[model samples]
Target chain A: MRPFEYASPNSKEQVAALLGTSWEQGAILAGGTDLLALMKDDVVTPRRLVNVKGIDTLRGTSYQPGNGLRIGALTTIAELADSKDLAQYPMLFEAVTEAASPQIRNLATIGGNMCQRPRCWYFRSGMGLMPMTKDGKSLVVAGDNRYAAILGTQTGAYFVSPSTIAPALIAYGAKVRIYSAKASGSGVRELPLGRFFITPKSAKEREHDLKPDEMVIELIVPPPPQNLKTGYFEVRQKAAFDWPLAMAAVALQMDGNTVKSARVVMGHVAPVPWVSDEAAATLVGKTITPDTAMAAANAAVTKAKPLSMNKYKITLAKAAVKRAVLKAGGAA
Target chain B: MADDRPRKPEDNSGVTRRDFMKVSAVGVAVPVVLGSVMDAAAEEVPIQGPGKVPITLQVNGKKLSAQLEPRVTLLDALRDNFDLTGAKRVCDRGACGACTVLMDGKPVYACAILAIDAQGRMITTIEALAEGDSLSPVMQAFVAHDAQQCGFCTPGFIVTTTNFLQKQPAPTAEEIRHGLSGNFCRCGTYDGIRAVALAHAGGKQS
Candidate 1:
């Protein structure tokens, strides 16, 4: 990695101030898991690194009765996986544990995970976010795109979202709390976690909604319904430390044997965590059975327009959805 | 606003416009002074460098000072500067656990951690696992079960396993396998490693 100026800020505002308003000037150094790799690969070379680890306030996970679960951005993946408070939301627990190796989980934070760059080889090989040829021909559309996005390909962005916990968080109705120097008053802003992800229209923009000057300080998950049941399932080639091929998270509000409401989110098969309203609609007011869950799973992937090499992802995604829905409904 | 809520420390000591623009000296469309803390005193933190900067690390019960750039990883610092080469550097990324070290009693990849960022944490490397003349229990098990072949990944495995046993002294067979998933052995010494881990777990061995 190239030499860079380091700033250890004690507060979120200082970090934002140091990071200016553009990606060229500085980058936030949260866990150093993804950022270090990007720097080493010369994918992103910021002149200054704003280390936010010194901000003591943004560190752990806690839950309040009325306010719900408030997880500090600096909480490590291992910390989240082992948090007793997360036991109530088993979908989140399952998703986190299925992430990278234990060693990585010890250092990788939830905030960094939220903003991690796409893991597309094209992107990693210094090809801009949207890889193009000399004459401006798209590389990922015809090239090796087995892991490219199946759902949001209508947008130019093709790389799959690398976050394992995003689907689960989105399913649980989580909100991301961002601290920006430009924000009015207290400089804090909260948006639904699903809205945090975006498909960049150009190479200069990021895949997430966060500005260069903003930092994700915390994640707030509202209290679940009284009869809430959630399940998360990921299909990977190996059981070891590897990214999932396809995954799904299912959250159901059950009225005894019937479903009152549902949220189904898919991961690793889209540019963003794909929330399927059709799948949710199929589950509402219907009793969850093997056939009904499979139908919902089928509806979840109905709109997946896979690239040449990724048609297999549609099958895996359907399996993931069926398994997650069944597990949430207590049918499996 | 909650009337009883404590006021932020930065509220009393206001951040000047000069400081904000001075720190962020780029194409900043909007410049605004901002600073706050939950409880820590509002003290100005000096920015360290692109060049070498002095930093002290708490490693293996010792305070070791070194002049290192911000980009220097903890693995490089431990091996090159401190001469603690027990933590190998295979697959410099966090994927392979060759450079595993215990940071604040948690096993973390030293290769993925910046030396400057590892300041206050208590880092325990493979060298610190043994007590003088005697090897640690996990090391003894590795020897007894012949759990190594090329021995390249042994230090990291030993460090990780020792920490794992500390947390779960009697882990099940599946737990042991899951615990050691971070480290990879190309020589396929997994059977021996599993045997050693099982033997170490004593009566609970499956």
Candidate 2:
């Protein structure tokens, strides 16, 4: 780790100022679970580290009935997993718990997890193994792409977004509050989780629409629908601290025994949280029987473009989606 | 009671002409010396530069303050500067809980936390588990059960078990497993560890 100046700012304004100063010089230090690893791996070398934990306003979990839950940016994953409010939002709790081991969760912040970099081995290893083009060639077209990506291939970067909470939040209809340095007042933009992600082809920018200097101050999850049932399911090799191979977050608005509306999102298969409105639309006005659930899951994966080694991910993703939908629908 | 005696400057040996010639030769090799000094300085640079960041931390029953960098991990600050080595460092990554410490009464991986982030929290480490020369009841139970083999992971287990006991002194076997799962024992002392935890939880100890 290179020597860097340290600052423990007391307010979000100070934090934004530090970040707005220069991207090349400063990096925000939240939980340090991911940032420290990146620093150790030499992936990012910032000249100054601005610690945000000292800010009193960036730390708690609040809930209001008929309104929503507002989680501070510095709230730890362990806190979220053990939150009482999360009992009303089981999908959020389950996603937070399934993210990493207890030790990792103890120190990983929710904001940091949402804004973490991709878990591409090539990116971490700094080997330039990602499909880069001298003129226009997909280098990862033939290499080890077992965990690359099954969607968003045209833009050439095939890395999975390793955030478990993002999919669940998206499924629950959460919005982010971003704070910028230059702005007189912080800007609050509310977008459904489905619209939060943009592929490289769709928008050649980064995963989330957060600017370089803006910080995610808090996440607000609107009150769930009266008849909505939500659940999250992830498939992994072992209980080891690796990202999920395939995951699904399902939220269904059921009318009696029939589904009225549904939100089914697949994770780790695309560059961002892949929301399947097509699959969701197929479930409305239909009974959530095994056949209906299977059809929805199959419909979700029809447009999936699997890489060579990651073809297994398509089956795994379908199974996850099916299980999550069944579980959320209370059929399992 | 003072026996005041002035020391004489004459007792010191004066510089020799040969030493002066040696110093002159070293001056001629100044570029190489300066280059090596600069290289050493670069390598010795601290990860977080020096500054007295005001942090109010309540550890155990006392409040303490220490100058630390934003990048200095809680594990490093505690072990290196504060001399509290009860928390071990096995896999510096959060994989192993050898550096588990409680913040605001909840267990957290010390190695994964930045010292600056832990400000204004009540931190409890393994060092606080003893009273005078006597070990805490949980520690005594661990010793009686022979739970520790090499003792590398003992501090983390002790701290984690202490926190768990604080929450639920009488935990079920499943709860014990879940609570201690954050820690790793390279020596496979899990059976004994479980026995110690159960014994303590069963009112055999505190």
The DockQ leader among the candidates is 1
Q: What's candidate 1's DockQ score? A: 0.36
What is the Cα-based lDDT of residue A57 in candidate 1? Answer: 96
Error of 2 at A140 (Å): 4.2
For every prediction, compared with the true complex, DockQ reads 0.36, 0.15
Candidate 1 lDDT, tens digit per residue, B38-138? 22223444556666778799999999998788789999999999999999999897878889999999999999999999999999999999989899888
Model 1, stretches more than 4 Å misplaced? Answer: B1-21, B24-43, B203-206
Provide the interface RMSD of candidate 1 in angstroms, 1 decimal place: 8.8
Instruction: Report chain B TM per candidate.
Output: 0.79, 0.70
Write one digit per residue (lDDT tens) for candidate 2, span B50-124.
Answer: 334444466777876776555567888888877889888777767788999888777888888777667677888
lDDT of 1 at B194: 82
Off by over 4 Å in 2: A127-140, A184-186, A198-205, A239-242, B1-69, B143-146, B200-206
Q: Which ten residues in a row have the lowest lDDT in candidate 1 chain A?
A: A12-21
Model 2, A1-332: lDDT tens per residue? 55555556666655544554444466888888888878867877776677877677988899998779999989989889888988779899888877776677777888898888788887777543244547555656667889988876667768887898899999888987777644554444555655656665422356666665677788889888788998688998856455799999999988998888899988998888888888898889987777888998899988888877889999999998888988988888
